[model samples]
Target: MSLKSIAAKLFAGVIYKKTQKWATNPVETQQRVFEGLIRKAATTSFGNDHNFGSIKNHSDFVSRVPIRDYEALKPYVDQVIKGDENILWPGKPLYFAKTSGTTSGAKYIPLTKESMPYHIEAARDAILHYIHETGNADFADGKMIFLQGSPELEEKNGIKLGRLSGIVAHFVPAYLQRNRLPSLKTNCIEDWETKVDAIVEETIDQDMTVISGIPSWVQMYFEKLKARSGKTVGNLFPNFNLFIYGGVNYEPYRAMFEKLIGRKVDSIELFPASEGFFAYQDSQKDKGMLLLLNSGIFYEFVKADEFFSENPKRYTIGEVELGVNYALIISTNAGLWAYNIGDTVQFTSLKPYRVIVSGRIKHFISAFGEHVIGKEVEQALRDAMEDSDAVVTEFTVAPQINPSADLPYHEWLIEFEQEPNDLAAFSNAIDASMRKQNVYYDDLITGKVLRKLVVTPVPKGGFERYMKAVGKLGGQNKLPRLSNDRTIADQL
Candidate 1:
């Protein structure tokens, strides 16, 4: 280890001890945090923003404004980027987190300094809580490898700046970020280029004690790691104690990766987007993680039974019900009130407030999670089709999860300008694409639920019909993947 890393670890040891002492008294720690949250609210402009200042009456707020969807808060995000100090916590506006939406180009979400801490705290607490629960306490003892997006931050005057992901590395406990991946080629940003080869080369020998990243990305890395390095990730990071994932469903890839690792690597699901880290898996091997940054977020939930046009009943942390798949709504410390993040979730139970990610209310694919959405599915199709030597001229996948005797699937109706000669290989390539893009789909294939993603070839002019009918295709948005299924992406 470098001298800087060793010294930082020594200092972290002190901080970790203090944190341990504080964590033992959960009630006291939270009460102080609660007080801090209150002070944070009371001193500022919650009342002006109609944000939760002192949710003295949770029921009162519940009755006043029902739960909201992402559209409900786009105006607030607008206010945030405008540098509304009272709302966005008074600072220079950082880069907006670009997220996909049905109605617009990537949503450039404003990330404020005040609210960004919540994401970091959630990530830290998830690891810490995992250690405490697992009886392996002192989470900082081992190396943690995060397959995070590389910095897209712009640099000027020898200083780099960017979004939440960039900020995450910029603020990483100092000991962690500088540790190179042992290979010259390391992590590449999630973009058009493939950095899998480089990362696989670097990581095969390292003792990566903890691994964190999106399930799909991790799965892809695992595949590349095994192929390029002649070692499974399990053999590579044999000392790894945890595999924390965010961004997508991990259950499908669970058995695959776990088997490769030789033992069940502890997994934690983190609910984080470009906007924030909303929740995390609390207990190791358990289904859910306790919400870490509750103090930073003014919590609210939209009852699934409630209609969007109707007011959404908001909830405080105390009022949140467990086990029901209610949509998560939040107003954070930095600024955002009654915001709908578009991601949907339901609680597995209450008391400790364990929850599950139901799915994106906006993003969906219904035929048993074969429901693909937006560019993700399209890219998969492109990769698969091209790889299979089947050139796709136009295609559209619609939710066909409805009851059908033949088969229920997120049906992909394709219109090829020229029918590829190798039809069977093309079909197999599409299957491979789906499997790779969604590990859950791969699990289903291996588990033998459905044969493959049902692809029905349409005429060459199929997507043109959609574009002509809708007047546009994929600039801001496209057709819905899940509408009537109500499973969101969770059914997969």
Candidate 2:
């Protein structure tokens, strides 16, 4: 083994042991994080406003600080944008992770000097955990590519601003610098298709072993490589054994990926965002990512079903239960206090606090009171695709509240890479799966309040074309698995 690989294995061992210390005492670790966040930020303007100084415990904290989404938090963010210091966190934020907002135009999530390291650390530890568990550090000796956004940043009020992935690019560990691929110039190319072409040209002959990105963007790169080289990804890069992905569930894309790569490869699922790095898949055998309790964030959860109700009770990490979907709320060293990041997650293992991203809090179909979520839809699709010839590239579900000839129903806009022999049968299978999972949907169907779902097959590259048209073709952008309205459905 190379010196770097040997050192990596050693480091992975050390990191794994350290992680186990906190993972084993998850609730206690979270309490420490909570206290630390509150203590550290107590003197800030937000803290003063929220009575952080007088807060004695979780109850006090929750009572004082109401959960605020980006819109509600914008006044403070606006102050920070105008060069205000000691508003959110102490002093100034190091950078602003610029993200696309739904109602708001642009959200500038603060990345403080204190909190930024955790983002880099969480990503690194995920790899380390993989290395430690599998005893495979050989990938460290080969080229690694993270298909991501431009590293370029814009200056605003003395703080750098860019996509979170772009900001993270600047923090790649020095040891891995030589192995990282897609030249900085290529990455800076504004157009995604052009950037993928550039990336393919750059990494085609390299010894690529580790590839990371949102699955959809990585799929684009993989497809590009297949087209150019006329070889399966596995054949092209024989050592490419580890695929790291986040932002969306990989199960939906697994079949397509297996076909493209021509084999099954080990994969890691990460739960990362601009707000914080919450969790990462710690074991290949496990179903969920291990929640990072010792990270510089305090977590709170409101049951997903009751999230919209007046004064929904927020539960601490200690109080959450397995199998119950909860809208994740967080307070962090980055100065977000009781911030609702809009993601819903379910605990799969509470012994060490492991969770699976269930859905977006706002991204759901409830037009007819059938509150179908992203996880359910994704699961339904996966169930339908199993033991079938269907291979989906991408899909989204939206309620069809009105129809020309039948009762309203769910419309599944799907872009299939390989269509099944019987479209009606495939649609029926999806509907059945959906009905099995969601009782409300099943009731609606059985009572004739709604018809079975209709599948609208999007033409080849239709979703890509739609994304490009909407100016969100690449990087961390992903299609919502399901939406309440037909905004995306109408466009598709």
Per-candidate Cα lDDT values, in order, are 0.56, 0.93
Q: In model 1, how large is the Cα lDDT of residue 110?
A: 60
After best superposition, candidate 1 residue 322: deviation in angstroms?
3.8
Measured by TM-score, how close is model 2 to the native structure? 0.99
lDDT of 2 by residue, 1-492 (tens): 888888989999999999989889888888899888889989999989988899889999978999899999999999999999999999999999999986889999999999999999999999999999998999999999998889999999899999999999999988889989988999898888889999999999999999999999999999999999999999999999999999999999999999999999999999999999999999999979999998899999999999999999999988888899899999999999899999999999988889999999999999989999999999989988985899999999998887888799899999999998899998999899989999999999999999999999999899999999999999889988888989999999
Residues 287-317 of candidate 1 have per-residue lDDT tens digits of 7645543345655667643525455555545
Question: What ranges in model 1 sit over 4 Å off?
Answer: 1-72, 79-84, 91-95, 135-143, 154-163, 178-193, 363-398, 401-492
Model 1 TM: 0.64
Q: Can you list the residue pairs that collide in candidate 2? A: none
Compared with the true structure, the alpha-carbon lDDT of candidate 2 equals 0.93
